[model samples]
Structure formats: structure tokens, C-alpha cells
Target chain A: MTDRQLKIIEIVKQSGPITSEQIATLLSVTRATLRPDLAILTMSGILDARPKVGYFYVGIDENNLIAKKLRSKKVEDLMSLPVVVGEEATVYDTIVTIFLEDTGSVFVTDGGFLTGVVSRKDLLKNAIGGIDINKIPVGIIMTRRPNIVMAFPDENISDVARKIIEHEVDSVPVVEHVKREDGKEGYKILGKISKINIARFFVELAGE
Target chain B: MTDRQLKIIEIVKQSGPITSEQIATLLSVTRATLRPDLAILTMSGILDARPKVGYFYVGIDENNLIAKKLRSKKVEDLMSLPVVVGEEATVYDTIVTIFLEDTGSVFVTDGGFLTGVVSRKDLLKNAIGGIDINKIPVGIIMTRRPNIVMAFPDENISDVARKIIEHEVDSVPVVEHVKREDGKEGYKILGKISKINIARFFVELAGE
Candidate 1:
């Protein structure tokens, strides 16, 4: 739908039972053009049209609406499969996986649980000037030593995006090995969240 | 570095002045076979060598140690620039951006400030199915409402990760619209976080 159509819907929601003629006048569109919009909205389940009357808001299926609008309700729906590495991994081993997998960072784990995170920056920083990549262990260059960015798969992307951006960081590590209150880890490493993910969901959609 | 090398480093770091034969005994390699391994590690700067005593642990450096084994550091040293998206969008638009960018999600914002986030699932569920993608206002499909995943640019990635897990999210959104303490809004989206990013850093330098 075009921006005008959305605007029309918003207007209708704000002022329902509005006549097509009234809408056309407000939007500077002809009544004929308004008819097509009304039809489109009706077909798309956004509105209910009546002859010799006006358009009323079409109540969405609560289930459908919830599924669409609430990320908190379904944040893990689109997460990718999870894969992790250990902190004890050698630089060569880490490099092979990173290059082969087309990934930018790797989560370092201990006993199947997240211990820390390492990114290209970490590797490059060590490799570029002072440290040599071949012999060094991953333990010395990690950004997670004093702190770590982490995620539990059950979360929504908005919360995750806020963390990455707020800290000026990239990805987070998944710690499925940790025991939960029920003696089970809350979630697994479903996938990685990125700025790109947010952009695809919001920016691109908004543009269209 | 493979798991094999990582073990070697751990053994040395924990117990230095160890011979290649002794290292091989623990790593399932023969003393003769471990010669190349020892050579490779020593040349890489992860280990120090002596003429007759044995090989010892090289001081920890970015290149020589594993990330998880290292002391945690700030994210500023690891995170990259942020990626952002506009607030208004359609489902179709979102699909195009997501596939094009290869990012997991995008940051949702208005006038350069982050408002919230929307994921692929957010678009698929909200914009697809019965919802009119072209007309429905994306502002309504925001996930993790009210900018829950908040972060400051100067903060560390580790700090952000901890909060992400604590907040139970896949990623965090970066913002710069700071409002005075008067309950006004002042925040802009700068970037995002994901497990992939953190995971990538921990890998060895061989791959990107």
C-alpha cells in the first residue's frame, strides 16, 4: 500500500464511519479513486465498506494481529540456527571456522556454555600490530573477559538491537549450558541478531 | 588454531617448561609428530622456546591467546559502526532489505533516532497473511516496545552483552537521542547487536 493509503487508514481509525467523498476531499483524491482504495482495504481486511454509507474500521483477528505486532510475544520466530565455539579454541581453528562460515564473530564457550565473545576486530587487533595470530590463544584478546554481550534465545529483537547499538557492539553469545531455576537452560542459540535484521524488518518494510 | 593447538596453549599456560613430548602425551600426538606443532605455535608468538629446558607459555597477547581465556575488556575495542533503518515500512519492503543486506534485522527509527525494532518474523507476521502490507502503519508492529534494549556508544560490548542476557534479548539497538531529565525524548539509532557478531570475534584470524 502507498503512504497515502496508510495515512487514510490512520485517519479512518482516528475518525471512523467516514464517507469516501469526505476522504477524497481530505486527500485531494477523486471519489472514483477513493472507491478503489476502499475496495483494496476491504479486500485486505483493513476496513468494511457499505453502500450509500461510509467505511468502518475492520477489526483484525486478535490472534493474527498479535502475531504481527508483538515482538515481545514472538521474538524467536525468525532466529537462525545456532553454532558456537570454545574459548580454548586455537586461533587457526577459530579462523578456519570464521572464514568458512562467513561469520564476523565467534562465541567462545566453556563446557558448552558461553564464556565470552570475539569479533573480527578482536582478531585483527591482535593480528595487525602487536600480537601474532598463529600462536596466541583466544583467551588474551577477548572483549568478554571483564564483560560479555550475551543473549538468551527467548528474547525479542528490539531489546537485543538496543543492547548492540547502545554499547556500540556487534553480536552477542548464547549460553545454553547454564542451568536455569528449573535445572534447564532457558533457551538455545537460535540465531544472531544484527542491525541488518532490524533494518530489514523495519526500514525496508517502511520504504515499501 | 584448532582445538589441538588450544589444548597445547592451555597446558603451557597452566604448566610451562613442558617438552613437546610431554605436550604430545596429553594431546594424543607423538613427540616426533608434535615437533611441527611446537614449531608452528612457537613461531606464532603464543609460546616461548628454550634451547634445552623446554617450551614455555608466551605472555598472553591478542594474537596468542583465546578470547574466553583472556581478561574481559570493553566493547569499544571490538564493536563496529552501527547500521540503522527508518521507522516506517511495509512487509514487502522489509523482505527486500533483509535478503539484500544479509543482516538478521534492522534498527527502526524516525528522523535518525531509534524508536524500536522489527524483525523478519515481525514483518512476516505483521505485514503478511491478512494484514495489508501496503497500508498498515509499521509503527504499530514494533517489537520490544519503548526501546527496551538501550545502550550508550561509549560503553563496552561485554557490558552490553550482559544486559542483553539480563534483559533476555537477541540483540541491542544503539541510540543517540538523549533527552534531559525532563521526560523528553532524545535518541537516535546508531547500530545493533547479534550473536553472530560476538561469535565471529572469538574465531581465529584465518577467516574474516
Candidate 2:
């Protein structure tokens, strides 16, 4: 979050369900500047308004609105793709690929169907106790049914943050907003956006 | 994950349910070095062990053991702390703290219970339409019931990546490993672990 936004929230809390017009006057800022903040607060589910009265704080659980909004954000906007993977040939071959690709998590797909996921830990755990890394089918050791976390293309940073909170997962996969109509290919793996990505994205956005 | 660990896995995957002594030989490393990785893999549920036969990969889709391990790594370890929130008197007041603190996220706790969270976007959303930021209580306007993400203290880089992949949230609230025994107060808030932190940390670790 930016400093200005924080300042604005302070003002609102100090006063009672005050009007935006009054706030603009008190803050000496134009309504236009304050507009974005108001929208964000409402989206966060913290703001409640009456026909004649102004907005007031709801409950502490109001963050749910923000969490819901985060889910709406597309993973594509956040994902990076053409994911690197080691080919499946033999156990030894897969072992070499794990190092060459240099990824903690690697995707294992056959004919591009999203077959499975493999991580260094997966390989290591299986390999302990003199298990064969070279001969065994990598498929046997790979994570089949890899948990797919996704993100939408157009969504707010808040929405992403909320999703992270709600799901308690680290990252969401970014699938293309629109897949091929034919459905010949599954959703292209755009990349992944995790809670960390959201954290850094905002830090950079805030110029902090 | 570390390169040494990967090497150990490769040796085992190629060798088979061999002894750790055999694994140590193939990797050209001591058994002591391999022990930690072996133990980790076995405990993570990726590798199943036999008293005499040795360990084997349980196959994929069982639950990303490594990812799950890293998922437990706390955001507090990765997150920044003394989180510095503005006086939570108004909805608008949050903006000031956001801007001044130069932080995107702020925690709100009364008597250290973590009542709510406020971000710059939260302030922006509320400040619009001449919304009075001061009058709106941040606790009321702030995000309540935020999705909680956690991490353990002994997290590796891969674990960080997995958390991002699993949770898809931007920021994780790093809390103490041991929760408060009696009440929530003992469970102190640590800094945060963000994607950026993970990325940066990995970059440094990789260099080493």
C-alpha cells in the first residue's frame, strides 16, 4: 500500500461515517484523488453506507470481500510460462534434467497434457536408501495430479492477496483467460503467481 | 532445494532401494551429508522407507512434500515487522500509515490479537467520493478475517517457492513457529516472507 492511502484511512477513522465531500475539504484534496481510495475500501468490504448517512466500518471479518476479489484476479496476469521441464526417458536421464533445469518444481507432461509435477524434494525422497534414479520410470516418482493454483488476467492486487489468505497456498497458476475454442490444448501454463509475488509486486508498486 | 540433495536423489533413483551406504558412495559424499536429505524426504511423505530394503518414491500427487514443508515456513521470517500501523481511529487514517510507513500492508491488533489488516488499496477504495478517511475506523473499514498463511522457521528456497505456488497470496504473515500456549499474545508476529524475498534469497543462495 502507498502512504497516501494509509493517511486517508487515518482520516476516515478519526472522523465518523463522514462524507467524501467533507473529507475532500478537510484533507484539502480533490474528490477525484479520494475516489480511488473509496472504491478500494468498499471492495475490501469495510465500508458500509446508508441512503442518507456516510460509510462506516463493518466488522473485522470484512476482509473476506477483499479475499473474494483476489480470487477474481487472473493468474495469467501474474504467471510466467513456457515452463522448463526435463524430458522423460530413463531415471538417470530425469536425474540429470532436474539439475539442468534448475527448478525446485518441474512439470512433467506427456503430449502436453499436464501429466504431473516433480520437485527436487520428490526426487530426493524417493531416491533415499539406494533407490534407482537412473532406471525407474520418472513417472513413478513424479507428483501426479499436481495441485493447480490459477489466477485471472484482470484482477486487483488486493484480490490476489485475499486469495492467498483464503486458500493458504503459496502460488496460483496463471491460466490463459481464454483457451482455444477447440479445446485441443489444455489451458496454456502462463506461469505462477504466489503470495510472494503479490507481496513484491505491491512493494514495487508502492515504490518501497 | 539444494544441489547436493538432488545429487543424492539421482544416486538413489538410479541405484534402487539400496542402502544409504551405497547412496553415499554413488554421490561421492559422506553418509552424514546424505542423512539429512534422506531423513527429510522420508518424513515429507514423498519417500517411503523400509528397514532393510531402503526408501522409495511414493509417486506423485500424494501431496508435494517439499512444497508442503516450505509452505510451513513462516511469512514472519520472510515478512518485515514492527509493522507500524497508523492510529486506527478512522477509515481514512490507514492511508497515512501506508504512505508514511512505505508499506503496502499493515496489521491492526488491539492488545496484540491482530484485529484486522489494512492496505493502501483499502484506503484508496474508501477515500473516493469525498469519503472522509479519518472518520471511518480502519478496523471497521479494514480487512477483517484475512486469509491466514504460515511458515516454519527452517524453510528452504524450494519451500518458499512451493508456498507461493500453493497459496497464491502475495504476502504471508510470518508468525512464530510455536503458537501461544495459553493465548494468542505469545504467538508474536514476525516479519513477512514475500515472493520478492524468496526470489532475492534464492538469488543469493544460488550464488553461494
Candidate 1, after superposition: displacement of residue B69 in Å?
A: 46
TM-scores, all models, native as reference: 0.36, 0.34
Q: What is the DockQ of candidate 2?
A: 0.02
DockQ of every model listed? 0.01, 0.02
Every candidate's fraction of true contacts kept comes to 0.00, 0.03
Worst 10 residues of 2 chain B by lDDT: B59-68
- Fnat for model 1 comes to 0.00
lDDT of 2 by residue, A1-208 (tens): 3456556566676785888887788878999998877665544344555656776665222223223333434445555543434346554565456456533355665655555665443453454324666577777776665454445566554555555555444444554544455666564455656545554433332221
- A-chain TM-score of every model: 0.59, 0.50
Question: Stretches of candidate 2 above 4 Å error?
Answer: A1-72, A86-102, A146-188, A202-207, B1-208
| RMSD (Cα, Å) of model 2 | 29.3
User: Which TM-score values does chain B get in all models?
Assistant: 0.56, 0.50
lDDT of candidate 2 over B1-208, digit per residue (tens): 3566556555666666878888888778888987877765554344567899986666323122222333444443554554645335676455555546645566676655555566543454455324555576777776664455545455543554556556554445555534456655533455655565654432322221
